[model samples]
Target: MIHSINNLLYFRQKNPGIRGSGISVNDPVLLPVLSELENLKTSLENYLSDKVEKLKIEISKGQANFPSILHVSILPRNQKVSNGIYVVMCFDILGRGILVGCAESITNPKGLNTVIRKQRGIKLNIDVDGLRPTTKYNNVFENPREFYFGSIDEKQLLDHISLSLDIALYNLGLAKKDDLTIAEKADTGANDQAFDPQNLADARTKIARQITARRGQKSFRDQLLRAYEYKCAVTGCDVVSTLEACHIMPYKGDQTNHIQNGLLLRSDIHILFDLGFLTINYKNKTVILNKEITSSYYGQFKAKKIFLPKKPSDHPHLDALKFHNEHEFKQG
Candidate 1:
C-alpha cells in the first residue's frame, strides 16, 4: 500500500499522462522501496562510512558495473511529526554506486505554501529568462512577496525542506511504487460535473495578471502570439521566433493585459507601429503611415490594410486604440 502511494505521487508529479489510470497488478513494484533504498544509502554514507567503503570495494571487484541505488524512509503515523509524512531516494549516477535517503513531515498551511511559492517562482523565472529583458534582471526581484508569504516560520521551513527533498527524489525516479487511488476516484467525480466556461475565463484573467506582473511587456508579446496565432497579423510573417506582440496602446497608458489590445507583427513593423510613425484605422481597417515618414522608406506600407485572422470587432480594444490615436499618433 505504501509503495502504491509512492508510485501514485511519482506518476502525478512526473507522468501526468498516467495519473487517471487506476492501480493494476501489472503496475511497477519497485516504486515504494526506491525511496527507502536511497535513505539507507545516505545513512550508510554518514554513520556507517566504513561499511559503505567495504561495500563499494566488494561491488567494484565484480566484473559487471554496479548501479547506484537510494533508499528513503517515511516515519510511521505513530512517529509522524506533521500531517503528511514523506521520504526521498537519490541515486549517485556519477560515482560510488550508492544511493541517498532523506525524510520529512509536513502538516501546516505554511509548509504547503512554501512548496507552491517555490514552484511559482521557478516557473516565472523560467518564463522571463526565455523571453526578452530591457533592464538587467528587472523582473527577477520585482515581486518577491508574490511568490512567498510572510507567514512561513522555521518549523514550517524544516517541514517544507524535507517534503521538497522527497519531491526531488520522486522527480529523479528513485521511488518504489505509486498510489493514486484517491486521485483516480476524484477524477471520476470531476468528469461527471458540468463544465463552467465562466470559471475558466476567470482563471485565464488571473493567470494573465500574474504573467503581466512578472514579465511586463513580454506578457503582451505572449498575448500577441496567441491573438495572431503566432503569425504576423499585418504581413503574414509566420516566423514565430521573430514575431513581436505590439500593443496598440502604449503599455504605460493601459496596464490591462487584454488580448484585444495587442497585435502580432514583425519586429521592424512593431517598432514603426509603436513610434507614432504608423497607425491602423478602425473605420476602414487600413494601416496608415504618417505623411512625415519618407515615401522612399515607408511608401509601400502606407494605406495598406492589415490582414488579421479575425474580424475588426474581435481586436484592438476600441478604447485602447482611441487612447493611442489621441496621445501617441502623429496626426497627418
Candidate 2:
C-alpha cells in the first residue's frame, strides 16, 4: 500500500533543500512522482465515480510559486464553493503523504467539527513549506488540517481521504450518501437476489414497448429515438431505458435541439460525451476516445463508425460535431 509513494519519499529524501518550487508537471525533480501521482489520480476518480453521480474531481494545474504538490480537489458540479474558494485534499511528499484542508476560512465551524468527529482520524498541524503560508501558496492548502495515513492499510487510507472529501462536500450541501448495505452486498455476494442481465433486458424492453404510447412534444429525446430507430448510435444498443438523447453542442435552447445537433447515445456514453472523454469525427463519423479512457471498457468503441440513421437529413451536424471535438473533447 505504501509502495504508491515510495518513489516520492525517495526523491524528497535525496533533495531536502531543493523544494522543486515549480508548479508545472514538467519540473525535472517532479519526474519520479509522476507515475504514482497519476495512479492515485485514477484511483480517486474510479472510487469516487461509483459514489457521486455528477462529480467533478480536479487536480491543481500551473500556478507560479506553488510547490510541486498534487492538490486533488473534489469540486461541486454546479456551484461556487465557499464564495469561490475550493476545498483541497493534497498529497504532500515532503510532509505527510495526504494533507486535508480547506482553501479558505470555514463559514460553518459546527458542520466542520461534526464531520471531523465522525471521521475520528488523527489530526495534526500542517507544518510543511507547501502548506504553511496562505500568501505564497494561495491555491494550495490553506487553513490546513492534517489527517495521518502513516502505517495504515489501503482500505483505511481511502476511507480517511474519502471522509475528508465528504467533509468538504457535506459542508457545501453537495454530499451524497453511499448505500453501504448495497455496496457490501455487491462486494460479498451476500445479496439474497442475484443480478441477472435478462432483468435489465426485460426492463429495457418494457420501456421500448411504452415509447409509442408516451405523450410528449415530439421532444428532442423523442425525435432522436425516432431518428436513430430507437437504438444507440455508437453501440447499436436497443435498451430504451439506457438510451439518451445527447446534444452534440451543449444545449442552449429550443434552437439547439435540432435532430442534426443530437445523437442517440447510451446513458454512460452521453455522460462521457458531455464530459469530453468521448467524441466523434464530423467527417468520418468514427468514434474517438480520450487517451485517458483508452484502456477502460469504452476503449473497444475507438475508431468504430457510429451507426447512422437512414435519412441523410437526420445525421449529426458537421458544425456541432466539430465544435464538440475542438472545444470540448480535445480541451478535456
Candidate 3:
C-alpha cells in the first residue's frame, strides 16, 4: 500500500529490527504491491497531465520533494509558496494537498466551501474569508485544503480533484500577470463565466470589477467623473451612479490609473467599450463603431464626437486612444 519511497523510508526508520525471516526490503510479495502502486500513480499522472495541458500551464516537481507530486503557479507572485516555487497543490499516495489560493477570489467562497463539505465529506480548514495562513512547508500557503483518500472510491476522488483544478485555472485566466497592482486584487474573486452561469445575472460584474474594484477605490471613479464633468463621455448621460471609470490600457499598476488613461462612460457603454464594440478615434476623438454594430441601436453614435475635458491636460491621452483602437477595437 506504500505508494511513495518516502513512506517506505519512514516505516523502516520507525521500525528497525521488525522484519521476519522471509520478509526483506525487497520481498517478492512487496513487488506486486509496488507494481499496483505504480499503475495507480500512472493513472493519476495521466489524468492530471491532460488537465494541465488544456490549461496551457506546465506541472513541475513538488517543493515537498515527495513522489507523485504536481505543482502549478496558480497564485500570484506575492502569495507563492516560495520565491521560485509556486506549488498550489501536491499529490501523494494518501491524496492531495491544495493551497486553494483562489478561495478568496471566487465569487461565492462560502457556497463553494459548503459544496465541498457536503459532496466530498471534507471541510476546508479555512478562515472567515476562506483563507488561512500556514507556516507549514515554510510559509507555503495563505489558504490550504487537504483531501485524503478515504472510503470514497479512488476514481471519484480523482474526478473531484480534477474539477477543483479547473476552478483554480478558471480564476488564473482572469488574473493578468502584467497587472499586479494591489488595487485590482479584490476583483480577482469574480466568478469565471466559463465556470458558472451566475455571471449573466450581473453582466456588468466583469468590467464593473475593473472600474470600482469594490474595495473603497472610489477615488478613481470620482476623479474620472470630475474630468468628464460627471457625464458619460459617449452618451453625455449625467447620472453620477450610472457612469463608470474605465482604463484605456488595462490597469498594470498605480501609475496606469492616471486621469489621461481613463474614460467616464455609462454602464452599458462601458460594457460595449470593454468588449471592443465601440472605440474613440485617436485623431478626431470621434466615436467609432465596429461594423458589426452599425445596424444596432449603437449605430447612432458611429461618427459622433465624444465629449472632451475642458482642460487639454484632462483629455484622454492620444497614445491611450491609439492603443485601444489598434489593439482592442473590433473593426468588424
Question: lDDT by residue for model 2 over 1-332, one digit each (tens)?
Answer: 35654444445445431354444556665655666666656777787776556666665455544344455566666744334334565554454455555443333222121112111243333323343333222223323445444543555456555544544554454543331111121234334668775654564444332222121213677789898998999999986756777889876556776899999999899999999999999889999999989899999999999999999999998999999889999533
Top candidate by TM-score: 3
Q: Could you arrange the candidates by TM-score from highest to lowest?
A: 3, 2, 1
Clashes of 3: 1
Give the Cα error of residue 37 in candidate 2, in Å: 1.7
Candidate 2 segments whose C-alpha is farther than 4 A from its true place:
16-25, 64-69, 79-87, 101-150, 176-332
Model 1 lDDT vs. the true structure? Answer: 0.43
Please, what is the TM-score per model?
0.36, 0.38, 0.39
Please provide, for model 3 over 1-332, each residue's C-alpha lDDT reduced to its tens digit, 9 standing for 90 to 100. 22442333333233321213123434453454344445545544565563443333233322322122223333332433332222243332122222333233222221111111211233333211111122122123322444343322344344444434433433345333222222212236543425554543344344334422422234567678888998999999986656887888877656777899999999899998999989999999999998888999999898899998898999999999999999999887
List candidate 3 segments past 4 Å from native: 1-217
lDDT for each candidate structure:
0.43, 0.59, 0.51
Supply candidate 1's per-residue lDDT for 267.
81
* Model 1 TM-score, 2 decimals: 0.36
